[model samples]
Target: MELFNSALGKNITFVHPKFFIIGGLTGIPNITFYYVFLFFVYIVSVVGNTVVMAVIYLDHNLRTPKYIAVFNLAFVDLFGNTALVPKVLDIFLFGHYYIPYNDCLTFLFFCYTCLSLQSFNLVALSYDRMVAIIFPLHYQVKVTHRFMFSFIASLWVFTIIAVLISVGLLTRLSFCKSVVINSYFCDHGQIYRLACNDHFPSYVIACLYPVIIFWLPLAFILLSYLYIGYTLVKVATGEERLKALKTCTSHVILVANFFLPLVGTNIAAVASYIHPNARIINSTLTYTIPALLNPIIYALKTEEVMNAVKKLWKKKTFINTA
Candidate 1:
């Protein structure tokens, strides 16, 4: 309230609009097809993550710190899509672009939290990978179940704090100007920029959040792998090196799937002009596809998970036959 009051320095009261019309892709051609595609992605994401979780729960062999992290990844992927894609369908497909102010904030909160956690979950996987290869003998001691669980919990706490602060700050702004948000969702930047008063603080957050959510986590993962590579080269034979690196294939693919597009999008935004619709499509796909792929990658690429899945299938078949 103070933040809003402070900005209300004039004779008039602050003007906060009742609703904001999300202006993202509203004018694009054939975007309904994209929305339909997003719905399909959401369904696949839900089913895939559920199967991953089911396999983990059913297979005792997967009850390790690493699979625990994988489980977290699957869950985050599931939640992120559920929070985002459906609302997207409702807004664009069903023509409910006018979102109430409070609902917009809630929408931003869940979307950002899950997005941030996706990156952190990658960090968790990277930590497990780093400890496993770099300190092979002490991997168990270093990456215990308690440690991974605690680490993930701490990450959630931190991520929630960051996202909440962003949401909380939005309450202080008075949207006297345009109420139409320019992005594909109730974007933090689009909403804050609509404020009629001082929004420097929000601008600062806008600059800082990408670093926290994207770059910092990304650098940590990359550096951890670098150290793992160094340690591997120092001690292991060529055959052993390939074997160690093989374990990282799924993580690498997932990381690249999530981060590279983000990096590219940012770079494209900076280097040249991009159609708003094109940017929206790129951003939406970048977040969604990796989620759909996460469980599939684990089920197909990781031998343990593949074996567990096959075993589950065989068990189900035998029981039905018997």
Candidate 2:
């Protein structure tokens, strides 16, 4: 855990460690290539998620409860990538590896908050889908804009409270040595691993945190989908069942896109035999790749979004021709 040594022929006792971020310590032959790749991902994530949010905001047809949830997810993705990728770029492209203590904590706070918000948003989207499929007649009556807004607001408040409690606990831990985090960005697990004091409380919180934030929401989503499936099966019309299943396809894809990398990263974290570089790589991809792909997946697979894009493009073309 001793991270520094003074070579002045004297014993050095006091050292305040500034975190050294080693971006994916994979020992790639060409680091610049990796930097360029990450830069492209950053740009795509920002632009794609921004465009998704903008389209959702401007289009009146997209102002439903489902698309409102999509808008929130896009916003979270945009905010998260903005908070994380620039610092990663600084580390890989500009060689600025030293992060101050407070800055590191701030980054970890926002990253955790955004991720937790996304999980809650997904649960909201699943509920929206369930209501739409199971009770189409009552969907409008029950899932009003006012209700959706209140639900989303409550989710934000809950996520903020949960993340603050966790981050507040994190800030109290002492980091006397071993400040080098072997990842591209400041992550909760990485930061907690470097604590020099009694981190039992933090460790307990960490173990329980994912269960509350991620798995619970995921379980709700699965149950919603299960109910939707049962409802579809009871429907006598083949076309109705197909339509219902089609509506759920994009959400299922999105859920897989977000959760697979997360599960992989968590697995790597606890597997002691895994390489540090592999763990770092998994963690980096867990956040960044999902942020980059979420919008793409929706635009390509979701019929409503694609129709919106086409309509917008046609309108632009008509205006240009006129």
lDDT of 2 by residue, 114-198 (tens): 8888788889888888998899899999899988999999999988877776666665567777777767777677777888876
Stretches > 4 Å off in candidate 1: 1-14
In the predicted model 2, the residue pairs found to clash are: none
Candidate achieving the largest TM-score: 1
User: How far off is model 1, as Cα RMSD?
Assistant: 2.6
Give the range of the ten consecutive residues with the poorest summed lDDT in model 2. Answer: 1-10
Candidate 1, residue 106: Cα displacement in angstroms equals 0.2
Q: 150 in model 1: Cα distance from truth in Å?
A: 0.3
TM-scores, one per candidate: 0.95, 0.88
Measured by lDDT, the strongest candidate is 1
Q: What is the C-alpha lDDT of each candidate?
A: 0.90, 0.80
Shift in Å, residue 105, candidate 2 = 0.4
lDDT of 1 at 134: 83
